[model samples]
Target: MGSISDETVEENADAPTYVPSLPVPNVQELVKEDPLQVPDRYVRDQDDILQVNDMSWLSSEIPIIDLSLLSKGDKEELNKLDLACKEWGFFQVVNHGVAKKVLQDMKDATTEFFELPLEEKNKYAMPPDDIQGYGHAYVVSEDQTLDWSDALILVVYPAQYRKLKFWPSTPKGYKDIIEAYSKGVKDVGVELLRSFSTIMGMDQDALLGLHEELVQALRVNYYPECSRPDQVLGISPHSDTSTITILMQEHDKHGLQIKHNGGWVPVKPIPDALVVNVGDVIEILSNGKYKSIEHRAVTNESKERISYASFLVPRDDVEIEPLDHLVDSQSTQKMYKKVVYGEYLRSSMKRRMEGKAHTQMAKVET
Candidate 1:
């Protein structure tokens, strides 16, 4: 086990004060009333939620990377990847070699599972005070306004930690499809982690070595069609807690939005492409060179959006921080304090649940 660094703080072992109450209502089970009416509970506290319907932003440039070339030792591709990581902080990967059939199967299975009755779906309901199974994530209070989306979360790595109880047995091939999809994602993520290291002027295995016990959690988010898409959020604006996240959205509706330049911009959906983003841990590990963008999901009046996010996280007890080589080689100062992955995650959860700034909670004083 790693010791907590002096620069970090973990009061009461950094456990969250607010524990979530279980058996919460699944948002997808609720009725999506009318095209112009939004439930008061789903209304966001913030007034601005991009009430306009504009596709002009899609015409603007966005990073859509081709991973097949990057894996073949193309220097230009490496440079592009580095730029996208440092500047865009988000990109879409295509031609990644994962079969289109596998992707589709996973999406089909997710849809079928969420489409089940409330009782059948709640069979995998999350335990009280935890956010690991079916239901809306981070529902800590009775009055806490909930997101307009329902999600199924599964931990699918490090065989020992697998909770078979929550694993679904429907759709015949659900388990196999997920296994294959996860393997493909892991292959891509491992390559990207190595690429990230190469771009940082460190040994290729420097960062990869930290993944001896890689933990991957999958969240299948179903953003049901909302009556008033202009007024409510499918998901709130927040950064992910993983080191990296691989996301796949249903091809038809594009609802993912990222904060940029001074406004929220949409990430257009490209068929068979996987969206990747730098997460908070990577920002700390890269010594603030890479960024974790704040992004959210918007609902649509007529279309529903389903997305799968594969989150790659470190073991809770593992030490997560910037590499010695990164700070030394670049002559850059360590801009954040090193903390155990578990503690930092708890702090982040509390901040997100209470509507606070979770991303910058660990910035070190320069």
Candidate 2:
């Protein structure tokens, strides 16, 4: 299962690039007009939940790894992480070494921003066809099923790409808090990817070297209390398009759910832990050895849950594929076509706008 790269042509360093996609109009504005109830426009008829016949899948637990142990290169811890990557595709980390103050302030910042008056918050409303700023992403069509949440989305990495207008300048120290939190998570993400290289028996720097021009996005999701929690989803069921994602959520509220064996399972919150997920990009990079799990968020009846997700992605111009070293006909087959991040982004926006799984477009046929 390890040597699948020979069959395909050696990858070219230069890949074609495409213009990035625009996002839908800010749906958060709509939320302010009618905050208490789910609007007809946001109500979805299609069931996003995966219905299951066998109830046993709920017993499958999401693994928790200690990042401190991973940093020390402990073989046993690395083995546990490898299993988590191959089996669950998601895990939680305690003692990850990110400052507790940074985590708390980041959460506080998300809450205070959402608590602002709608008019105040709308100053940085996402532009049409743009994915950044405060707005609902993928609300591309009038008929799309809207999520039951408000989000402050912004690009965090490569300082040049950041749009300060949307960064919430009104908060006394919002930008500083966000900057520290973003840097902390990025440090952790890089280490996590390094460990993945070891797990796959590749050069210690194989994956990180391929993705030097790193990109990241900060998605602060606010899931408000819904009168009909059962009738609406906070976010739809879909796999992440990025290479990896690190998430922080409040310990008391549980809204994230992962689809497992045709059933939805809730992700319990653990204090001071970051939830890491292997994304679709990583699946392709590993020749499908690691997978991107389908997950979604459900609404709460009483408490509002705020989740801070830092998406780790490569430059859109970078080419993504199964690394040559990871492929072999024995087990690790090249299951996807080489993908340019810009093209992937455009397709993702189009599919999400139309409410479809965009990641499928990158799959290679046997």
Candidate 3:
């Protein structure tokens, strides 16, 4: 453990390009105070509580992709990747080349971070006018329903974009572990993008060329156990707005569920495998060939859950739209309108999470 100094946080209080989220109560401490009587604000209605009532859809599992096979140019693996994107829009990645020790180190550091005293953790709290820090995100108003979690949101890639002032200075090597894990995950993301381009019958650079740079950010969610778990959601159902989201479940606990075929299916965690899912950007660039799945986190009745989601996006200024290959003259219509990544991101940050609502902003209705 290391001591936290306020100097760095004070110096960068007004970080540029940040979208502000309204301050929210810290769920972890609140639960410690009383796990039973959840505040009215955290209590959600039945519809919100159970987005999909039917669970018969759990019979099918999301696709699992082997990176080693894909790297070998295996035709069968390629076909599987293509089908996974177009159909399920979600998959688990194995043999991804990220070392087990690195992953475990990150998980341990994060667990230690959340275990710190509230006041110590508060040293990295999200500023009143910026969302990139340790706190709830997308809380745009006081009346909005709250999720039963606390999150640390940070931009990790494009190294220049990182605001280290918001990063934890404790647990000794927290920063280094996060950097190593992020790099490994980023390599996977770029490779997946290449696979997607190849699937579309274009060269490897086809999709990668759409943006000037690949941006990566991370959101570490800490879902505390709730006594009235049925009444509170860990996170609201929403599709990621990035090009792709790579998720790692740190605690080996089940909380992630994706909406599938009009019902919700719990995502079973495969040890050492990371979950990857298409996002709105891919859906738009694919001209709707690839769909972004709607998913949410459910609270556990007894155990806590922690997950890290790495969001890979394009450069903020790029104009994102259906690719030329997907929107050929023979095509019936272009399914999505063009959007500037920065504008789309700002819009998403300024509002609360709504199921697939951010993705809808880019749709070109027929």
> In model 1, where is the ten-residue run with the lowest total lDDT?
3-12
Show pairs that collide, candidate 2: 1-331, 1-332, 3-327, 3-328, 4-327, 4-328, 5-327, 22-129, 23-129, 23-130
| lDDT tens per residue, model 3, 69-155 | 887778999999999898788999999888999889989999999999999999989888877789989988899999999999988
lDDT of 1 by residue, 202-255 (tens): 777766678667788888888888876766788887888888999988777888
- Per-residue lDDT of model 2, residues 276-307, tens digit only: 99887898888888888887888887767899
lDDT values, one for every candidate: 0.75, 0.77, 0.86
Error of 2 at 74 (Å): 0.6
Error of 2 at 158 (Å): 1.3
Candidate 2 stretches with Cα past 4 Å from truth are 1-36, 53-60, 330-332, 353-356
* All candidates in order of lDDT, best leading: 3, 2, 1
Give the lDDT of residue 9 in candidate 2. Answer: 28
Per-model C-alpha RMSD: 7.2, 8.4, 2.9
Count of residue pairs whose backbone atoms collide, per candidate: 0, 10, 0
